[model samples]
Target: MVRGACTLTAERADTDRVLDALPGLWQGFSATLIRDCRLRFRRRSELANPLIFFALVVTLFPLGLAPDSTLLSGIAPGLLWVAALLAVLLSLDGLFRDDFDDGTLEQLLLAPQPAGVLVLAKIVAHWLTTGLPLALASPLLGIMLSLPGHSMGILMSTLLLGSATLSLVGAIGAALTVGLRRGGVLLSLLILPLYTPVLIFGAGTVRLAVEGAPLAPWLALMGAMLALSLLAAPWAAAAALKLSLDG
Candidate 1:
């Protein structure tokens, strides 16, 4: 009886420690996110480039292809997804490049907090500065492309989910190529293939929305991808960062 009672007490103490760790972990994560966000947005031109690139790519589709609404609407979903993916990819090369150049990334790896948490925070910052803005700006491009009005919501939704997934996936590529002088091309080559599934379902979501079909399945797939990527991407990215640091 005494042994069982002691065991219960030990379990309770372990539970208490786990509960206590949650708040401290959250504080650390939030602080890192805020710091990275401030650093990223401090320069206006650099911050605006991705959003601009997204818009330009979308805009060019209308001019390059026929201006007819029927044809444009048919292709808009894929066009937008492809453009957003490229924009996200463009921003990724710089994810750890600057930090590596100046040794800040090394500092982050050495910090007491887990490197996975740090990588997750950086990914969040990347999504906020680059991905979120692209999603917000997408509706304007959608309208310009003559995309069906009803599809606008789904377009934004997919970009939000899809872009977050892209940022997470791209970070892994970024971490791996961060030490290279010509890392941009290598990052794109490594990440573009991994990006294919998200691109397919993301464009499919908007296409279904435009056709007035049920959206649950595509959105479900996207949500599942997001969940799985959320669990896996940061840890993979952190490991890549450690490898880069080793050399």
Candidate 2:
């Protein structure tokens, strides 16, 4: 009788321990996420400067490509949107690179919070820095691209949703290649193929607007892509970070 009682007691204690730890774990994860976000915004000066470079790149397109209003109008949406995507990619490395450089990433791996949460926190920061700015700037660039005023809402909406996915998906490549000396090219090579679907859906949504097609299908695809990437990319990035750290 005593033996059975003790056995039940041990199991209950174990269950209690697990239940107690859940809140602490959640708190730690939340703190990590909030910290990354706070740090990112605090360095807005450094981060916001990337928009300037993106704007300059967009301006150069008209000069380099045909200056014909009709041609520019036809291709402007695609070119400007693609340029924004490329600009976000250009800045993805800065997401994890600084933490890795300063050995903070290693410490994060050692934290009580799961590595996946840490990865997610960083991705959130990247989205705030790169994706949010691009979304806000898309309207101005949309005008530059000769996108009709009627399509501004669609262009901005698509860019906002699509770029969030871009930041998340691109972070996996950035995290995977972060410690490598020559990772820039490799990161692009690894991520661009993955980014293609997002680019297609994003541009497709805007193009649909230009042609007066239904917005539902493209928006659905973009939402699905964003949801999937948000759900899965963190796990992949976390696994990659573990591998990199282990090596």
| Model 2 TM-score, all chains together | 0.87
C-alpha RMSD by candidate, in order = 8.2, 6.4
lDDT of each: 0.92, 0.84
lDDT of model 1 at residue 191?
A: 98
Model 2 stretches with alpha carbons more than 4 Å out: 1-19, 22-26
CA shift at 103, candidate 1, in angstroms?
1.1
lDDT of 2 at 170: 90
| The candidate that achieves the highest lDDT relative to the unseen native structure | 1
Please give me the total number of clashing residue pairs in predicted model 1: 0
Query: Which tens-of-lDDT digit does each residue in 129-239 have in candidate 2?
Result: 788888888889878777788998898899889999998899899888987888899999999999998888888788889888889988988999999998999989988
Model 1 residue pairs with clashes: none
Which 10-residue window in model 1 sums to the lowest lDDT? Answer: 17-26
lDDT of 1 by residue, 103-202 (tens): 9899988876888998899999999999999999999999988898888999999999999999999999999999888899999999999999999999
Off-target runs (Cα >4 Å) in candidate 1 are 1-23
**Number of the top-ranking candidate, with TM-score as the measure:** 1
